[model samples]
Target: MVKSFMTLAVLVLSAAGVYAQDIIQVQGTTPDLYVMHTVKKGETLYSLGRTFSLPIKDIAAENNISADKGLQLGQNIKIPLNGANFSQKADAASGGAPLYHKVEAAETLYRLSLNHNKVPLDNIRKWNNMSGDGLKKDTYVIIGYLKGGSGAVAHTPTPTPAPTPAPAPVNNTPAPAPVNNTPAPVSNNNPAPPIENNTPAPTPAPTPTPAPAETKPVASSGSSFESLYMQQTSNGKNATTEKGPGGWFKSNAAAGKYYALHNTAQRGTIIKVTNPLNGKYIYAKVLETIPQIKGNAGLIIKLSDSALEALGTNDPKFYCELSYEN
Candidate 1:
């Protein structure tokens, strides 16, 4: 009886360890840096709030659900990671479970750092035991941990499943015979007479006309986010405007998908960014707040590198005007 009890206890502990390891599966990140979470059985808004260190009401408003409504199992939700709740400081490890960002296609280490509130690039390397800047798609990279969550960060890299080999195509079409374009060789035994042709001096072939130079199309200053901006402010409920110095960061987002990091605008809010120097403008979506780094001090906004180029500026910092719906 004693041996059976000991065996049962070991099995329960092993199961608990497995559960903890699988608890934090990252779905994806929002434009504003919020991580998506799928609701699990027994997870209430109140409990989620406690787990993520966010106010219950904030979570409810973010997902457009009533605070009193219970979360359904497998329902998707977003966990906000603003300055108020998220942290990347080395000391923050003591407070929460590590949060991870699943690397997407063409995502670079530099872009990853900028997306995650500009966490130090070295810190990211240290956390994942990465020896270089390269990252494979679908690899989970630790961005930071939740401030009040449980469990230690398991640094074990998620194994990427090997891709299945595609079947070789079978070709049934026969290949065409090679064309012989060489002229026939003359035989020395049969001396052929040379035929002289006077075809009117070949009409002095007209000088070939030079083709016109190709011109590259100029990139438009317009942004695809413009429609989103218009829709967001169609009601004009919380319109706000500001003009100040703006900074820029590298991004892998497609051209014209301009994005920004502002201190006050809510994530996903579209802001009209205009370069006062040249009157160039673009509508940029706010991702999150400008990271509290030394060089970022005093900047009103941070634009993606593509957004800055669309604005027709090479300057890393420039004066700009912004209009957005609160």
Candidate 2:
């Protein structure tokens, strides 16, 4: 079986690597900001990096997979093409040991070690404490962690946002309750300043269906998305504005230098972050979304360790400010 798997891998990689190279399926899976690649039968992380022109460690870090645990067949893992350029030095910051991979079906001690750039199976057994060939799924295995942190993130084609549905056609024939033509005497209390209506004044009946406004990216604050988002969440004064109350962030993979985790910025959007305490700032592209989990509301945004250090420190929960120009 091992011999067959190896042969299959080389053959498929040799053939498919040329034609389907770098074709990552776009998955708008929550939180992540890159294309998703489904694990295939004859593939390993190393081969995947080769096909996509990325480093294996970057792929491991992106999904936070420990080398030993191994990928499951058909598992959907994020491909951080944008995360490739990051330095791997931050792996030291995560810990001394390499991140472990959780085992999945059809994975063996031999296959697992082979997938890890051919680390010896005996060493794998020694590291994880083993006595025999038997192995279990859903367990973590170490494949050796990396030393650098700033890995390269090559840009790939971005998928277009899903098309918005057309608005229902407005009926022009029925005029709005035919406002009385007769002039009325002016009232003393000039009708309280238009009552704060946000509705776009019913799109005058003249042009029955106005073309939808073209969407352009904008630095958001005061946009309705922000207004609605801010209404539900609590924050320090001005926290919701570009200036922030950010903290040190967590990433599955080692995020490249100057990358950040924001709850609202669209993936690939670049924003500037500042360490208010020291007045140091750097621009980072938005790489992933910080989920709004109800239990963890201490910080508004999180910066990668490299980003945190770039801003000058690695305080686990440090706070900072941010600015965006779309």
| Tens-digit lDDT string for candidate 1 (77-133) | 877777666777756666677777777897767667766676765677676666556
Q: What is residue 121's positional error in candidate 1, in angstroms?
A: 0.9
The candidate 1 region of ten consecutive residues with least summed lDDT is 161-170
**Best model number under TM-score:** 1
Relative to the true structure, candidate 1 reaches a TM of 0.43
- TM accuracy, model 2: 0.28
Best by lDDT: 1
- Residue 172, candidate 1: alpha-carbon lDDT: 27
Query: Which residue pairs collide, candidate 1?
Result: 99-144, 99-145
Cα lDDT, all candidates: 0.70, 0.51
Clashes of each: 2, 25
